[model samples]
Target: MPVKVRGGLYNPYDGHIDPYSVTQALAAGARHYGAVLRPHTEVTGLRLREDGRWTVTLGHGAQLTARRLVNAAGGN
Candidate 1:
């Protein structure tokens, strides 16, 4: 069988990222701003409150509210 090609795209500014290093730097920056890093915490649910705050439900039935949320769930 034969195929026909239409067009292609290219960019000279393309780059790759080291996710681990980037995450470490970001975590350090966030910690400098009083952000608490909880390791091994499982989030069960999340909801947006009427006051524009986020409600995060944990696996242990504990709920936390914050104005901003960052989902940095990594892969295995």
Candidate 2:
């Protein structure tokens, strides 16, 4: 998310359309393609362990472990 791209529709031509729904649809497709979609969940913390794995702590008191953390969190 850039400073200028606050709303969902970051394109100037398609500025009239809502970007939120587009993002949701993409998330659904990604989930169908083996992606995990965690909506409305805030990442309270991310820590890289000595074993080279990452730990993600959610605001809801949930913890998840993964190999890496790719913070493509803006659109999804």
Candidate 3:
């Protein structure tokens, strides 16, 4: 089991996650729950709609309506 890690030493951790495996697992789980995963898609613009929905613009003039958005881009 992995424990909560708080910074103390130069490098202190009890566990690590395989990025590739975790990503694949998350994608699979999302798909299993009927969520569409669009790879290679870039967000170009964002707009708030009057109906409380979000208008997300993607690369190459694609757009989508999302009820929620999460900023999961870590250090990128």
Candidate 4:
């Protein structure tokens, strides 16, 4: 047996992926784990209460309390 080629590259960890689909799947998984998804909502401010909880202020002066917060602010 003989092989002939000008140039080539092989990698076992190389592949193509659709970013939008991946993002959607991740969001779905988060939702399954009881994650609230609020799109187009802007976080105005954050305050720590005396009880060690976080008071997150959103746009239009709306506020919500949470034990933990995740800032996944994507690019513009």
Candidate 5:
């Protein structure tokens, strides 16, 4: 058997950065923008408020309010 391809291999720019460094930088930037990062918190429910904001219900009956929510769950 034989395999055929129209285009050959294309290698883009190669780079590497420490994962911890990236995470730290993102945390710092978020803090600079007045964003709060809550680790170890589990989201139990989510609902839209009357003012179009989001009411996030966390574990232990804790709640959070945000005008916008970003679900960065999966990798790019």
Candidate 6:
């Protein structure tokens, strides 16, 4: 089970669990089930190439081209 916390609402149902810790645990659990972990990376743009591939540009000029792309940015 996991707890959801936002802006320190202080929900009473969740047992003594920190929101940040729970978030970290959930992310780890996701990665454990075959997920790619990329930290401190930003996607600037994505474009479909002529060969039916995706080219992604990051903030640090890091570019990666792949046949598929999954954008999972947390809401601001």
Off by over 4 Å in 1: 1-19
RMSD (CA, Å), candidate 6 to true, equals 6.7
Best of the two (2, 5) by TM-score = 5
If scored against the real structure, what TM-score would every candidate get?
Answer: 0.66, 0.53, 0.60, 0.71, 0.69, 0.49
**Model 1: pairs clashing at backbone N, Cα or C within 3 Å:** none
Model 6 misplaced stretches (Cα beyond 4 Å): 1-35
Predicted structure with the largest TM-score when compared to the true one:
4
- Report backbone clashes per prediction: 0, 0, 0, 0, 0, 0
The weakest ten consecutive residues by lDDT in model 5 span 1-10
List model 5 lDDT by residue over 1-76, tens digit each.
Answer: 2355433334366456567787799889988998887776788899999999999998899899998876644343
Q: Write the per-residue lDDT of candidate 3 for residues 1-76, one digit (tens) a residue.
A: 2455432223257456676787799789978977776666788999999999999898899899987776444434
Summarize candidate 1's per-residue lDDT along 20-40 as a digit string, tens digits.
787799899999998878878
Q: Give me candidate 6's TM-score against the actual structure.
A: 0.49
Instruction: Sort the predicted structures by lDDT, highest score first.
Output: 1, 4, 5, 2, 6, 3
What do the candidate models score in CA lDDT, each in turn? 0.83, 0.77, 0.74, 0.82, 0.77, 0.76
Pairs of residues at least 3 apart in sequence or in different chains that clash in candidate 6: none
Off by over 4 Å in 4: 1-14
Candidate 4 global TM-score: 0.71
Better of 2 and 6 by TM-score: 2
Superior candidate under lDDT, 1 versus 2: 1
Query: Lowest summed-lDDT stretch of 10 residues in model 3?
Result: 2-11
lDDT of 4 by residue, 16-68 (tens): 66768878998999899888988889999999999989999998899999877
